[model samples]
Target: MPVLRVHLDSDRSTARRVLQLHQEGKIHHESREAAREQVWRRGHTPAGDPTFVGITNGRRHVQLLYDVEVYSDTVL
Candidate 1:
């Protein structure tokens, strides 16, 4: 089955940090609301700005949009 992907667009360092947090299971976003809230957190970027989030629903539709698996069956 396909999953929802939410990516926080930022500089290389910030992207790496977010990716690390996601991989380590520190961030758990199982819905669109949760993903928007968590992904656009303060201090996510060097200038203390909310990171830009790019979301997509499926895998076959896009080749480069989805980067992180942030949603699950329990959607809000």
Candidate 2:
């Protein structure tokens, strides 16, 4: 199966969610750490940089970015 890489600016909760989804058969991978690391590395690079921004209305809010990838069954 093809491996999918997901990028996100998240916390421990988000990481847990990703793992849960994988265990539930909702995703092809077991966790989001690899994807997270990939994003961080890209952000540190020069070309094709990746960044995450947060927005709020009036109240205080926290947001996270999430990237999900689906793989082919042939490779799974």
Encode model 1's per-residue lDDT on 1-76: one tens digit a residue.
Answer: 2233444333444444544665675542333233455434521212122222433334334211223333234333
lDDT of 2 by residue, 1-76 (tens): 2233334434555545655564565642323344445644544222222222221122333233434332233221
Model 2 misplaced stretches (Cα beyond 4 Å): 1-6, 27-76
Clashing pairs in 1: none
Alpha-carbon shift of residue 57 in model 2 (angstroms): 31
- For model 1, give the 10-residue run with minimal summed lDDT: 42-51
